[model samples]
Target: MNDFFSTTILIATVASGIRLATPFLLASLGEALGQRSGVLNLGVDGVMLMGAFVAYFVVLKTGNPLIGAAAGILLGMVFGLVYAFITVNLHAEQGVSGIGIYLFGLGMSDLLFQKLVGTPLPIMPFPEIHIPLLADIPIIGPMLFTHSLIVYVAFLLVPAFTLLLNSTTYGMNIRAVGENPAAVDSLGVSVTKVRYSAIIIGNGLAGLAGAALAIELGIFQHNLTNSMGFIAIALVYFGAWRPFGVMAGSLIFGMVAAIVLQGKTLGIIPRSASDLAAMAPAVITIFALVLVANRFKQPAALSKPYERGR
Candidate 1:
Protein backbone atom coordinates (compact mmCIF):
# COMPACT_ATOMS: atom_id res chain seq x y z
CA MET A 1 0.00 0.00 0.00
CA ASN A 2 2.80 2.36 0.90
CA ASP A 3 4.55 1.61 -2.36
CA PHE A 4 1.44 2.38 -4.35
CA PHE A 5 1.26 5.85 -2.82
CA SER A 6 4.88 6.64 -3.50
CA THR A 7 5.42 9.73 -5.65
CA THR A 8 6.88 7.77 -8.53
CA ILE A 9 4.09 5.25 -8.60
CA LEU A 10 1.41 7.93 -8.30
CA ILE A 11 2.88 9.93 -11.14
CA ALA A 12 3.14 6.90 -13.32
CA THR A 13 -0.44 5.97 -12.58
CA VAL A 14 -1.77 9.43 -13.41
CA ALA A 15 0.20 9.52 -16.65
CA SER A 16 -1.09 6.13 -17.62
CA GLY A 17 -4.59 7.24 -16.71
CA ILE A 18 -4.34 10.19 -19.06
CA ARG A 19 -3.15 7.90 -21.79
CA LEU A 20 -5.99 5.47 -21.21
CA ALA A 21 -8.50 8.30 -21.43
CA THR A 22 -7.57 9.15 -25.01
CA PRO A 23 -9.92 6.78 -26.81
CA PHE A 24 -12.82 7.53 -24.48
CA LEU A 25 -12.40 11.25 -24.89
CA LEU A 26 -12.30 11.05 -28.66
CA ALA A 27 -15.29 8.73 -29.05
CA SER A 28 -17.51 10.47 -26.50
CA LEU A 29 -16.85 13.85 -28.05
CA GLY A 30 -18.05 12.54 -31.38
CA GLU A 31 -21.13 10.98 -29.84
CA ALA A 32 -21.94 14.24 -28.13
CA LEU A 33 -21.90 15.95 -31.49
CA GLY A 34 -24.27 13.41 -33.01
CA GLN A 35 -26.63 13.55 -30.06
CA ARG A 36 -26.62 17.32 -30.26
CA SER A 37 -27.88 16.95 -33.81
CA GLY A 38 -30.62 14.52 -32.72
CA VAL A 39 -29.00 11.27 -33.86
CA LEU A 40 -28.48 8.29 -31.62
CA ASN A 41 -25.81 5.94 -32.88
CA LEU A 42 -25.61 2.86 -30.71
CA GLY A 43 -23.20 1.02 -32.97
CA VAL A 44 -20.21 2.97 -31.72
CA ASP A 45 -18.61 -0.21 -30.39
CA GLY A 46 -18.83 -1.86 -33.79
CA VAL A 47 -17.42 1.21 -35.49
CA MET A 48 -14.56 1.20 -33.03
CA LEU A 49 -13.80 -2.45 -33.70
CA MET A 50 -13.70 -1.87 -37.41
CA GLY A 51 -11.46 1.16 -36.93
CA ALA A 52 -9.11 -0.71 -34.65
CA PHE A 53 -8.65 -3.61 -37.06
CA VAL A 54 -8.14 -1.35 -40.05
CA ALA A 55 -5.68 0.84 -38.21
CA TYR A 56 -3.78 -2.22 -37.02
CA PHE A 57 -3.62 -3.72 -40.49
CA VAL A 58 -2.56 -0.45 -42.08
CA VAL A 59 0.18 0.07 -39.54
CA LEU A 60 1.31 -3.49 -40.01
CA LYS A 61 1.66 -3.00 -43.74
CA THR A 62 2.95 0.57 -43.88
CA GLY A 63 4.68 1.03 -40.54
CA ASN A 64 3.14 4.53 -40.34
CA PRO A 65 0.70 5.18 -37.56
CA LEU A 66 -0.47 8.40 -39.21
CA ILE A 67 -1.57 6.65 -42.39
CA GLY A 68 -3.24 3.98 -40.31
CA ALA A 69 -5.08 6.58 -38.29
CA ALA A 70 -6.25 8.25 -41.51
CA ALA A 71 -7.50 4.94 -42.79
CA GLY A 72 -9.46 4.43 -39.60
CA ILE A 73 -11.06 7.88 -39.88
CA LEU A 74 -12.02 7.23 -43.49
CA LEU A 75 -13.61 3.90 -42.70
CA GLY A 76 -15.52 5.41 -39.81
CA MET A 77 -16.91 8.13 -42.09
CA VAL A 78 -18.04 5.48 -44.54
CA PHE A 79 -19.91 3.68 -41.80
CA GLY A 80 -21.35 6.98 -40.71
CA LEU A 81 -22.76 7.54 -44.21
CA VAL A 82 -24.43 4.14 -44.18
CA TYR A 83 -25.89 4.72 -40.75
CA ALA A 84 -27.17 8.12 -41.75
CA PHE A 85 -28.87 6.65 -44.79
CA ILE A 86 -30.69 4.07 -42.74
CA THR A 87 -31.76 6.23 -39.83
CA VAL A 88 -31.94 9.66 -41.43
CA ASN A 89 -33.14 8.93 -44.97
CA LEU A 90 -34.83 5.55 -44.74
CA HIS A 91 -36.29 6.46 -41.34
CA ALA A 92 -35.38 3.12 -39.84
CA GLU A 93 -35.44 2.76 -36.09
CA GLN A 94 -32.16 4.25 -34.90
CA GLY A 95 -31.66 1.68 -32.15
CA VAL A 96 -32.25 -1.32 -34.40
CA SER A 97 -30.14 -0.01 -37.24
CA GLY A 98 -27.36 0.86 -34.85
CA ILE A 99 -27.37 -2.68 -33.47
CA GLY A 100 -27.29 -4.09 -36.97
CA ILE A 101 -24.28 -1.93 -37.80
CA TYR A 102 -22.59 -3.05 -34.60
CA LEU A 103 -23.16 -6.72 -35.40
CA PHE A 104 -21.81 -6.31 -38.89
CA GLY A 105 -18.71 -4.48 -37.67
CA LEU A 106 -18.10 -7.05 -34.94
CA GLY A 107 -18.35 -10.05 -37.24
CA MET A 108 -16.59 -8.42 -40.14
CA SER A 109 -13.61 -7.23 -38.14
CA ASP A 110 -13.05 -10.68 -36.62
CA LEU A 111 -13.53 -12.43 -39.94
CA LEU A 112 -11.08 -10.13 -41.62
CA PHE A 113 -8.50 -10.77 -38.96
CA GLN A 114 -8.87 -14.53 -39.27
CA LYS A 115 -8.61 -14.48 -43.04
CA LEU A 116 -5.93 -11.85 -43.48
CA VAL A 117 -3.70 -11.89 -40.42
CA GLY A 118 -4.41 -15.29 -38.83
CA THR A 119 -2.66 -14.15 -35.65
CA PRO A 120 -2.21 -11.01 -33.59
CA LEU A 121 0.81 -8.98 -34.59
CA PRO A 122 2.56 -6.06 -33.00
CA ILE A 123 2.89 -2.84 -34.95
CA MET A 124 4.77 0.38 -34.48
CA PRO A 125 2.69 2.75 -32.38
CA PHE A 126 2.83 6.51 -32.26
CA PRO A 127 5.85 7.83 -30.40
CA GLU A 128 5.52 10.19 -27.48
CA ILE A 129 6.24 13.87 -27.91
CA HIS A 130 7.41 15.71 -24.85
CA ILE A 131 6.51 19.39 -24.71
CA PRO A 132 9.65 21.54 -24.70
CA LEU A 133 9.62 23.37 -21.36
CA LEU A 134 6.52 21.90 -19.80
CA ALA A 135 7.74 18.35 -20.10
CA ASP A 136 10.80 19.20 -18.05
CA ILE A 137 8.77 20.04 -14.95
CA PRO A 138 9.15 17.45 -12.21
CA ILE A 139 5.88 15.55 -11.78
CA ILE A 140 3.46 17.81 -13.62
CA GLY A 141 5.40 17.80 -16.84
CA PRO A 142 5.69 14.09 -17.25
CA MET A 143 2.11 13.41 -16.28
CA LEU A 144 0.56 16.10 -18.47
CA PHE A 145 2.92 16.97 -21.28
CA THR A 146 4.55 13.78 -22.39
CA HIS A 147 2.28 11.57 -24.46
CA SER A 148 1.54 10.47 -27.99
CA LEU A 149 0.12 13.08 -30.38
CA ILE A 150 -3.27 11.40 -30.16
CA VAL A 151 -3.39 11.90 -26.40
CA TYR A 152 -2.78 15.61 -26.73
CA VAL A 153 -5.26 15.88 -29.59
CA ALA A 154 -7.91 14.13 -27.54
CA PHE A 155 -7.50 16.52 -24.65
CA LEU A 156 -7.29 19.55 -26.88
CA LEU A 157 -10.56 18.55 -28.47
CA VAL A 158 -12.43 19.18 -25.24
CA PRO A 159 -11.83 22.88 -25.60
CA ALA A 160 -12.24 22.83 -29.34
CA PHE A 161 -15.60 21.11 -29.11
CA THR A 162 -16.79 23.38 -26.37
CA LEU A 163 -16.09 26.35 -28.58
CA LEU A 164 -17.60 24.79 -31.67
CA LEU A 165 -20.83 23.76 -30.01
CA ASN A 166 -21.34 27.07 -28.29
CA SER A 167 -20.08 29.71 -30.70
CA THR A 168 -20.56 28.58 -34.27
CA THR A 169 -23.55 29.08 -36.61
CA TYR A 170 -23.61 25.40 -37.47
CA GLY A 171 -23.40 24.58 -33.81
CA MET A 172 -26.49 26.67 -33.11
CA ASN A 173 -28.28 24.89 -35.93
CA ILE A 174 -27.36 21.55 -34.45
CA ARG A 175 -28.72 22.51 -31.05
CA ALA A 176 -31.89 23.86 -32.58
CA VAL A 177 -32.29 20.79 -34.72
CA GLY A 178 -31.88 18.48 -31.76
CA GLU A 179 -34.41 20.34 -29.71
CA ASN A 180 -36.91 21.04 -32.50
CA PRO A 181 -36.08 19.92 -35.99
CA ALA A 182 -39.34 21.10 -37.48
CA ALA A 183 -38.70 24.68 -36.46
CA VAL A 184 -35.17 24.58 -37.84
CA ASP A 185 -36.44 23.06 -41.08
CA SER A 186 -39.23 25.64 -41.36
CA LEU A 187 -36.57 28.33 -41.10
CA GLY A 188 -34.81 26.89 -44.21
CA VAL A 189 -32.13 24.77 -42.53
CA SER A 190 -32.05 21.23 -43.87
CA VAL A 191 -32.51 18.83 -40.95
CA THR A 192 -31.20 15.92 -42.98
CA LYS A 193 -28.04 17.78 -43.92
CA VAL A 194 -27.26 18.83 -40.37
CA ARG A 195 -27.89 15.35 -39.01
CA TYR A 196 -25.84 13.74 -41.73
CA SER A 197 -22.93 16.05 -41.10
CA ALA A 198 -23.08 15.37 -37.37
CA ILE A 199 -23.14 11.61 -37.89
CA ILE A 200 -20.14 11.69 -40.19
CA ILE A 201 -18.11 13.75 -37.76
CA GLY A 202 -19.18 11.59 -34.84
CA ASN A 203 -18.32 8.29 -36.51
CA GLY A 204 -15.05 9.69 -37.80
CA LEU A 205 -14.06 10.53 -34.28
CA ALA A 206 -15.04 7.05 -33.09
CA GLY A 207 -12.81 5.57 -35.76
CA LEU A 208 -9.95 7.76 -34.67
CA ALA A 209 -10.60 6.67 -31.09
CA GLY A 210 -10.20 3.05 -32.11
CA ALA A 211 -7.07 3.79 -34.06
CA ALA A 212 -5.61 5.62 -31.10
CA LEU A 213 -6.32 2.65 -28.83
CA ALA A 214 -4.79 0.14 -31.20
CA ILE A 215 -1.69 2.22 -31.83
CA GLU A 216 -1.27 3.15 -28.20
CA LEU A 217 -1.15 -0.54 -27.29
CA GLY A 218 0.89 -1.42 -30.40
CA ILE A 219 -1.18 -4.55 -30.90
CA PHE A 220 -4.64 -5.70 -31.91
CA GLN A 221 -6.66 -8.78 -31.10
CA HIS A 222 -10.24 -9.98 -31.39
CA ASN A 223 -12.44 -7.67 -29.33
CA LEU A 224 -9.48 -5.48 -28.52
CA THR A 225 -11.76 -2.66 -27.43
CA ASN A 226 -13.75 -4.93 -25.08
CA SER A 227 -16.94 -2.83 -25.44
CA MET A 228 -15.16 0.46 -24.89
CA GLY A 229 -17.37 2.02 -27.56
CA PHE A 230 -20.44 1.32 -25.44
CA ILE A 231 -18.69 2.88 -22.48
CA ALA A 232 -17.96 5.91 -24.61
CA ILE A 233 -21.65 6.17 -25.42
CA ALA A 234 -22.54 6.04 -21.74
CA LEU A 235 -20.03 8.76 -21.15
CA VAL A 236 -22.13 11.00 -23.41
CA TYR A 237 -24.97 10.70 -20.91
CA PHE A 238 -22.60 10.97 -17.96
CA GLY A 239 -21.28 14.19 -19.46
CA ALA A 240 -24.79 15.55 -20.04
CA TRP A 241 -23.95 16.04 -23.71
CA ARG A 242 -21.18 18.49 -23.01
CA PRO A 243 -17.51 18.29 -24.02
CA PHE A 244 -15.99 19.33 -20.70
CA GLY A 245 -18.35 17.00 -18.89
CA VAL A 246 -17.32 14.17 -21.17
CA MET A 247 -13.66 14.88 -20.48
CA ALA A 248 -14.31 14.64 -16.76
CA GLY A 249 -16.08 11.33 -17.21
CA SER A 250 -13.33 9.92 -19.40
CA LEU A 251 -10.66 10.93 -16.92
CA ILE A 252 -12.51 9.28 -14.07
CA PHE A 253 -12.81 6.01 -15.94
CA GLY A 254 -9.22 6.24 -17.15
CA MET A 255 -7.85 6.91 -13.69
CA VAL A 256 -9.78 4.03 -12.21
CA ALA A 257 -8.56 1.68 -14.91
CA ALA A 258 -5.00 2.83 -14.42
CA ILE A 259 -5.27 2.30 -10.70
CA VAL A 260 -6.57 -1.21 -11.25
CA LEU A 261 -3.76 -2.03 -13.67
CA GLN A 262 -1.21 -0.56 -11.30
CA GLY A 263 -2.58 -2.54 -8.40
CA LYS A 264 -2.28 -5.73 -10.40
CA THR A 265 1.28 -4.93 -11.36
CA LEU A 266 2.18 -4.31 -7.72
CA GLY A 267 0.52 -7.54 -6.70
CA ILE A 268 -1.73 -5.55 -4.42
CA ILE A 269 -4.63 -7.13 -6.28
CA PRO A 270 -4.44 -10.85 -5.68
CA ARG A 271 -4.35 -13.07 -8.74
CA SER A 272 -7.53 -14.76 -7.55
CA ALA A 273 -9.32 -11.45 -7.90
CA SER A 274 -7.88 -10.45 -11.25
CA ASP A 275 -11.15 -10.98 -13.08
CA LEU A 276 -13.05 -8.96 -10.48
CA ALA A 277 -10.51 -6.18 -10.68
CA ALA A 278 -10.97 -5.95 -14.40
CA MET A 279 -14.64 -5.17 -13.79
CA ALA A 280 -13.87 -2.01 -11.84
CA PRO A 281 -14.08 0.40 -14.79
CA ALA A 282 -17.41 -0.97 -15.97
CA VAL A 283 -18.79 -0.83 -12.44
CA ILE A 284 -17.77 2.80 -12.16
CA THR A 285 -19.43 3.58 -15.48
CA ILE A 286 -22.77 2.13 -14.35
CA PHE A 287 -22.78 4.11 -11.13
CA ALA A 288 -21.92 7.26 -12.97
CA LEU A 289 -24.71 6.69 -15.48
CA VAL A 290 -27.22 6.20 -12.68
CA LEU A 291 -26.14 9.31 -10.86
CA VAL A 292 -26.27 11.56 -13.93
CA ALA A 293 -29.26 10.19 -15.80
CA ASN A 294 -31.89 12.20 -13.92
CA ARG A 295 -29.84 15.35 -13.68
CA PHE A 296 -29.47 15.76 -17.40
CA LYS A 297 -32.24 15.94 -19.95
CA GLN A 298 -31.31 14.51 -23.28
CA PRO A 299 -32.14 16.34 -26.51
CA ALA A 300 -35.88 16.48 -27.18
CA ALA A 301 -35.62 15.01 -30.65
CA LEU A 302 -32.99 12.40 -29.95
CA SER A 303 -33.56 9.00 -31.62
CA LYS A 304 -36.68 10.36 -33.41
CA PRO A 305 -36.32 10.54 -37.16
CA TYR A 306 -37.37 13.87 -38.61
CA GLU A 307 -39.73 14.09 -41.55
CA ARG A 308 -40.01 17.67 -42.81
CA GLY A 309 -43.76 17.68 -43.22
CA ARG A 310 -44.77 15.34 -40.40
Candidate 2:
Protein backbone atom coordinates (compact mmCIF):
# COMPACT_ATOMS: atom_id res chain seq x y z
CA MET A 1 0.00 0.00 0.00
CA ASN A 2 2.74 2.40 0.92
CA ASP A 3 4.70 1.61 -2.21
CA PHE A 4 1.66 2.20 -4.39
CA PHE A 5 1.57 5.80 -3.28
CA SER A 6 5.27 6.38 -3.69
CA THR A 7 6.00 8.94 -6.42
CA THR A 8 8.27 6.61 -8.31
CA ILE A 9 5.78 3.77 -8.26
CA LEU A 10 2.95 6.04 -9.34
CA ILE A 11 4.94 7.43 -12.26
CA ALA A 12 6.05 4.00 -13.39
CA THR A 13 2.51 2.69 -13.27
CA VAL A 14 1.18 5.56 -15.36
CA ALA A 15 3.99 5.23 -17.88
CA SER A 16 3.42 1.53 -18.22
CA GLY A 17 -0.28 2.12 -18.63
CA ILE A 18 0.33 4.57 -21.48
CA ARG A 19 2.72 2.16 -23.15
CA LEU A 20 0.26 -0.70 -23.03
CA ALA A 21 -2.62 1.44 -24.34
CA THR A 22 -0.94 2.21 -27.68
CA PRO A 23 -2.15 -0.87 -29.55
CA PHE A 24 -5.68 -0.60 -28.23
CA LEU A 25 -5.86 3.09 -29.11
CA LEU A 26 -4.64 2.67 -32.66
CA ALA A 27 -6.83 -0.37 -33.33
CA SER A 28 -9.91 1.20 -31.83
CA LEU A 29 -9.50 4.32 -33.93
CA GLY A 30 -9.46 2.20 -37.06
CA GLU A 31 -12.47 0.19 -35.92
CA ALA A 32 -14.34 3.40 -35.20
CA LEU A 33 -13.77 4.61 -38.74
CA GLY A 34 -15.04 1.38 -40.26
CA GLN A 35 -18.08 1.31 -38.02
CA ARG A 36 -18.88 4.90 -38.87
CA SER A 37 -18.80 3.92 -42.51
CA GLY A 38 -21.26 1.13 -41.72
CA VAL A 39 -18.80 -1.73 -41.53
CA LEU A 40 -17.84 -3.86 -38.57
CA ASN A 41 -14.45 -5.59 -38.54
CA LEU A 42 -14.49 -8.51 -36.15
CA GLY A 43 -11.23 -9.90 -37.52
CA VAL A 44 -9.00 -7.11 -36.24
CA ASP A 45 -7.28 -9.47 -33.82
CA GLY A 46 -6.32 -11.83 -36.59
CA VAL A 47 -5.00 -8.96 -38.67
CA MET A 48 -3.07 -7.84 -35.62
CA LEU A 49 -1.47 -11.23 -35.28
CA MET A 50 -0.27 -11.07 -38.85
CA GLY A 51 1.05 -7.57 -38.32
CA ALA A 52 2.88 -8.51 -35.15
CA PHE A 53 4.64 -11.40 -36.79
CA VAL A 54 5.56 -9.39 -39.87
CA ALA A 55 6.87 -6.48 -37.84
CA TYR A 56 8.91 -8.78 -35.67
CA PHE A 57 10.31 -10.46 -38.74
CA VAL A 58 11.16 -7.12 -40.34
CA VAL A 59 12.95 -5.81 -37.29
CA LEU A 60 14.71 -9.10 -36.87
CA LYS A 61 16.06 -9.04 -40.41
CA THR A 62 16.64 -5.33 -41.13
CA GLY A 63 17.00 -3.98 -37.57
CA ASN A 64 14.83 -0.97 -38.38
CA PRO A 65 11.74 -0.32 -36.29
CA LEU A 66 10.36 2.27 -38.76
CA ILE A 67 10.63 -0.18 -41.63
CA GLY A 68 8.97 -2.80 -39.51
CA ALA A 69 6.14 -0.42 -38.73
CA ALA A 70 5.73 0.42 -42.42
CA ALA A 71 5.70 -3.25 -43.31
CA GLY A 72 3.02 -3.88 -40.72
CA ILE A 73 0.86 -1.15 -42.27
CA LEU A 74 1.35 -2.61 -45.74
CA LEU A 75 0.41 -6.10 -44.62
CA GLY A 76 -2.63 -4.66 -42.95
CA MET A 77 -3.63 -3.03 -46.23
CA VAL A 78 -3.34 -6.39 -48.00
CA PHE A 79 -5.53 -8.09 -45.42
CA GLY A 80 -7.90 -5.17 -45.64
CA LEU A 81 -8.21 -5.69 -49.37
CA VAL A 82 -9.11 -9.33 -48.82
CA TYR A 83 -11.67 -8.40 -46.21
CA ALA A 84 -13.10 -5.67 -48.41
CA PHE A 85 -13.51 -8.17 -51.20
CA ILE A 86 -15.43 -10.58 -49.01
CA THR A 87 -17.63 -8.14 -47.16
CA VAL A 88 -17.99 -5.32 -49.63
CA ASN A 89 -17.70 -6.85 -53.08
CA LEU A 90 -19.16 -10.31 -52.49
CA HIS A 91 -21.71 -9.02 -50.03
CA ALA A 92 -21.05 -11.89 -47.65
CA GLU A 93 -22.38 -11.98 -44.12
CA GLN A 94 -20.06 -9.62 -42.32
CA GLY A 95 -19.92 -11.45 -39.01
CA VAL A 96 -19.17 -14.89 -40.40
CA SER A 97 -16.67 -13.65 -42.94
CA GLY A 98 -14.86 -11.69 -40.27
CA ILE A 99 -14.51 -14.80 -38.16
CA GLY A 100 -13.08 -16.62 -41.14
CA ILE A 101 -10.48 -13.92 -41.62
CA TYR A 102 -9.61 -14.12 -37.94
CA LEU A 103 -8.97 -17.86 -38.05
CA PHE A 104 -6.96 -17.58 -41.24
CA GLY A 105 -4.71 -14.90 -39.78
CA LEU A 106 -4.28 -16.77 -36.51
CA GLY A 107 -3.19 -20.02 -38.19
CA MET A 108 -1.18 -18.42 -40.97
CA SER A 109 0.82 -16.25 -38.59
CA ASP A 110 1.73 -19.24 -36.43
CA LEU A 111 2.77 -21.32 -39.44
CA LEU A 112 4.95 -18.55 -40.80
CA PHE A 113 6.59 -17.97 -37.43
CA GLN A 114 7.34 -21.65 -36.90
CA LYS A 115 8.69 -22.18 -40.42
CA LEU A 116 10.85 -19.09 -40.48
CA VAL A 117 12.05 -18.42 -36.93
CA GLY A 118 11.78 -21.95 -35.43
CA THR A 119 12.26 -20.47 -31.96
CA PRO A 120 10.84 -17.32 -30.40
CA LEU A 121 13.72 -14.89 -30.23
CA PRO A 122 13.75 -11.42 -28.74
CA ILE A 123 15.15 -8.53 -30.77
CA MET A 124 16.14 -4.98 -29.96
CA PRO A 125 12.89 -3.12 -29.33
CA PHE A 126 11.94 0.41 -30.35
CA PRO A 127 14.07 3.01 -28.68
CA GLU A 128 12.49 5.61 -26.45
CA ILE A 129 12.36 9.12 -27.95
CA HIS A 130 12.15 11.49 -25.04
CA ILE A 131 10.83 15.00 -25.62
CA PRO A 132 13.64 17.42 -24.92
CA LEU A 133 12.45 19.70 -22.11
CA LEU A 134 9.06 18.21 -21.27
CA ALA A 135 10.60 14.85 -20.48
CA ASP A 136 12.70 16.60 -17.84
CA ILE A 137 9.76 17.79 -15.79
CA PRO A 138 9.63 16.20 -12.36
CA ILE A 139 6.70 13.74 -12.63
CA ILE A 140 4.59 14.74 -15.58
CA GLY A 141 7.50 14.48 -18.00
CA PRO A 142 8.18 10.80 -17.53
CA MET A 143 4.52 9.94 -17.31
CA LEU A 144 3.59 11.64 -20.57
CA PHE A 145 6.63 12.09 -22.80
CA THR A 146 9.13 9.31 -22.08
CA HIS A 147 7.75 6.67 -24.41
CA SER A 148 8.61 5.42 -27.90
CA LEU A 149 7.57 7.33 -31.03
CA ILE A 150 4.69 4.91 -31.58
CA VAL A 151 2.99 6.02 -28.39
CA TYR A 152 2.96 9.63 -29.46
CA VAL A 153 1.80 8.68 -32.92
CA ALA A 154 -1.12 6.71 -31.49
CA PHE A 155 -2.26 9.58 -29.30
CA LEU A 156 -1.76 12.09 -32.08
CA LEU A 157 -4.04 10.03 -34.28
CA VAL A 158 -6.85 10.45 -31.78
CA PRO A 159 -7.25 14.13 -32.62
CA ALA A 160 -6.60 13.56 -36.28
CA PHE A 161 -9.23 10.83 -36.41
CA THR A 162 -11.68 13.06 -34.62
CA LEU A 163 -11.13 15.76 -37.18
CA LEU A 164 -11.42 13.31 -40.02
CA LEU A 165 -14.72 12.00 -38.71
CA ASN A 166 -16.27 15.23 -37.53
CA SER A 167 -14.93 18.11 -39.56
CA THR A 168 -14.06 16.76 -43.00
CA THR A 169 -16.09 16.19 -46.16
CA TYR A 170 -14.97 12.58 -46.34
CA GLY A 171 -15.96 12.08 -42.74
CA MET A 172 -19.42 13.41 -43.54
CA ASN A 173 -19.74 10.90 -46.35
CA ILE A 174 -18.84 8.08 -43.99
CA ARG A 175 -21.45 9.11 -41.44
CA ALA A 176 -24.02 9.53 -44.16
CA VAL A 177 -23.31 6.15 -45.66
CA GLY A 178 -23.50 4.43 -42.32
CA GLU A 179 -26.77 6.11 -41.55
CA ASN A 180 -28.39 5.81 -44.97
CA PRO A 181 -26.38 4.52 -47.85
CA ALA A 182 -29.31 5.00 -50.13
CA ALA A 183 -29.42 8.67 -49.37
CA VAL A 184 -25.67 9.08 -49.70
CA ASP A 185 -25.74 7.15 -52.95
CA SER A 186 -28.53 9.30 -54.30
CA LEU A 187 -26.46 12.32 -53.40
CA GLY A 188 -23.64 11.22 -55.77
CA VAL A 189 -21.35 9.62 -53.21
CA SER A 190 -20.18 6.04 -53.62
CA VAL A 191 -21.28 3.77 -50.78
CA THR A 192 -18.98 0.97 -51.82
CA LYS A 193 -16.02 3.31 -52.05
CA VAL A 194 -16.59 4.77 -48.60
CA ARG A 195 -17.06 1.41 -46.93
CA TYR A 196 -14.10 -0.10 -48.73
CA SER A 197 -11.88 2.78 -47.69
CA ALA A 198 -13.12 2.57 -44.11
CA ILE A 199 -12.49 -1.15 -43.84
CA ILE A 200 -9.01 -0.81 -45.28
CA ILE A 201 -8.11 2.05 -42.97
CA GLY A 202 -9.45 0.17 -39.95
CA ASN A 203 -7.57 -3.03 -40.68
CA GLY A 204 -4.45 -1.09 -41.54
CA LEU A 205 -4.56 0.52 -38.13
CA ALA A 206 -4.90 -2.91 -36.54
CA GLY A 207 -1.74 -3.98 -38.32
CA LEU A 208 0.11 -0.92 -37.11
CA ALA A 209 -1.13 -1.57 -33.60
CA GLY A 210 0.24 -5.08 -33.72
CA ALA A 211 3.59 -3.85 -34.93
CA ALA A 212 3.78 -1.34 -32.12
CA LEU A 213 2.97 -4.01 -29.56
CA ALA A 214 5.52 -6.47 -30.94
CA ILE A 215 8.32 -3.94 -31.24
CA GLU A 216 7.68 -2.58 -27.79
CA LEU A 217 7.84 -6.04 -26.24
CA GLY A 218 10.88 -6.94 -28.40
CA ILE A 219 9.70 -10.48 -29.08
CA PHE A 220 7.36 -12.54 -31.19
CA GLN A 221 5.57 -15.66 -30.03
CA HIS A 222 2.45 -17.63 -30.78
CA ASN A 223 -0.69 -15.58 -30.08
CA LEU A 224 1.35 -12.47 -29.47
CA THR A 225 -1.65 -10.14 -29.33
CA ASN A 226 -3.40 -12.38 -26.76
CA SER A 227 -6.84 -11.07 -27.79
CA MET A 228 -5.88 -7.42 -27.67
CA GLY A 229 -7.70 -7.01 -30.97
CA PHE A 230 -10.89 -8.37 -29.44
CA ILE A 231 -10.50 -5.96 -26.56
CA ALA A 232 -10.01 -3.18 -29.08
CA ILE A 233 -13.36 -4.02 -30.65
CA ALA A 234 -15.07 -3.96 -27.29
CA LEU A 235 -13.49 -0.59 -26.69
CA VAL A 236 -15.24 0.69 -29.79
CA TYR A 237 -18.54 -0.06 -28.09
CA PHE A 238 -17.39 1.26 -24.75
CA GLY A 239 -16.45 4.53 -26.38
CA ALA A 240 -19.76 4.60 -28.22
CA TRP A 241 -17.71 4.61 -31.43
CA ARG A 242 -16.29 8.05 -30.81
CA PRO A 243 -12.61 8.96 -30.99
CA PHE A 244 -12.20 10.61 -27.58
CA GLY A 245 -14.49 8.07 -26.03
CA VAL A 246 -12.39 5.24 -27.39
CA MET A 247 -9.27 6.98 -26.14
CA ALA A 248 -10.80 7.25 -22.67
CA GLY A 249 -11.77 3.59 -22.60
CA SER A 250 -8.34 2.51 -23.83
CA LEU A 251 -6.67 4.54 -21.12
CA ILE A 252 -8.84 3.03 -18.43
CA PHE A 253 -8.06 -0.44 -19.64
CA GLY A 254 -4.36 0.28 -19.95
CA MET A 255 -4.16 1.75 -16.46
CA VAL A 256 -5.98 -1.20 -14.96
CA ALA A 257 -3.67 -3.60 -16.80
CA ALA A 258 -0.63 -1.74 -15.59
CA ILE A 259 -1.90 -1.85 -12.05
CA VAL A 260 -2.59 -5.56 -12.19
CA LEU A 261 0.86 -6.24 -13.63
CA GLN A 262 2.56 -4.17 -10.97
CA GLY A 263 0.47 -5.70 -8.22
CA LYS A 264 1.63 -9.16 -9.23
CA THR A 265 5.28 -8.11 -9.08
CA LEU A 266 4.84 -6.31 -5.75
CA GLY A 267 3.23 -9.31 -4.04
CA ILE A 268 0.08 -7.26 -3.62
CA ILE A 269 -1.93 -9.80 -5.60
CA PRO A 270 -1.54 -13.49 -4.97
CA ARG A 271 -0.32 -15.73 -7.79
CA SER A 272 -3.30 -17.94 -7.16
CA ALA A 273 -5.57 -15.14 -8.35
CA SER A 274 -3.56 -14.25 -11.42
CA ASP A 275 -6.22 -15.36 -13.83
CA LEU A 276 -8.89 -13.18 -12.27
CA ALA A 277 -6.43 -10.35 -11.90
CA ALA A 278 -5.80 -10.54 -15.63
CA MET A 279 -9.54 -10.31 -16.19
CA ALA A 280 -9.66 -6.88 -14.58
CA PRO A 281 -9.34 -5.00 -17.89
CA ALA A 282 -11.85 -7.10 -19.80
CA VAL A 283 -14.35 -7.06 -16.98
CA ILE A 284 -14.06 -3.35 -16.62
CA THR A 285 -14.46 -2.91 -20.35
CA ILE A 286 -17.63 -4.96 -20.33
CA PHE A 287 -19.07 -2.92 -17.55
CA ALA A 288 -18.21 0.24 -19.39
CA LEU A 289 -19.79 -1.12 -22.53
CA VAL A 290 -23.01 -1.79 -20.71
CA LEU A 291 -23.08 1.72 -19.37
CA VAL A 292 -22.56 3.23 -22.83
CA ALA A 293 -24.94 0.95 -24.66
CA ASN A 294 -27.91 2.95 -23.40
CA ARG A 295 -26.33 6.25 -24.31
CA PHE A 296 -25.05 5.76 -27.83
CA LYS A 297 -26.46 4.87 -31.24
CA GLN A 298 -24.67 2.48 -33.55
CA PRO A 299 -24.26 3.11 -37.25
CA ALA A 300 -27.55 2.28 -38.97
CA ALA A 301 -26.17 0.05 -41.72
CA LEU A 302 -23.45 -1.64 -39.71
CA SER A 303 -22.92 -5.27 -40.77
CA LYS A 304 -25.47 -4.87 -43.57
CA PRO A 305 -24.37 -5.15 -47.16
CA TYR A 306 -25.46 -2.65 -49.78
CA GLU A 307 -26.43 -3.33 -53.37
CA ARG A 308 -27.11 -0.84 -56.17
CA GLY A 309 -30.84 -1.36 -56.37
CA ARG A 310 -31.44 -2.67 -52.88
> What RMSD does each model have against the real structure?
1.2, 1.1
lDDT of 2 by residue, 117-212 (tens): 988888778899899999999999999999999999999999999999899999999999989999999989989899889889889999999999
| After superposition, candidate 2 runs with Cα above 4 Å error | none
C-alpha TM-scores of all predictions: 0.97, 0.98
The CA lDDT at 310 in model 2 is: 80
lDDT for each residue of candidate 1 in 79-111, tens digit (9 for 90 to 100): 999999999999999999889988988899999
**Candidate 1, 45: how far from true, in Å?**
0.8
Number of the predicted model whose lDDT against the real structure is largest: 1
TM-score of 2: 0.98
Considering summed lDDT, which 10 consecutive residues are worst modelled in model 2? Answer: 285-294
The alpha-carbon deviation from the true structure for residue 230 of candidate 2, after best TM-score superposition, in angstroms, is: 0.8
Off by over 4 Å in 1: none
RMSD of 2: 1.1
Report how far off residue 29 is in candidate 2 (Å). Answer: 0.8
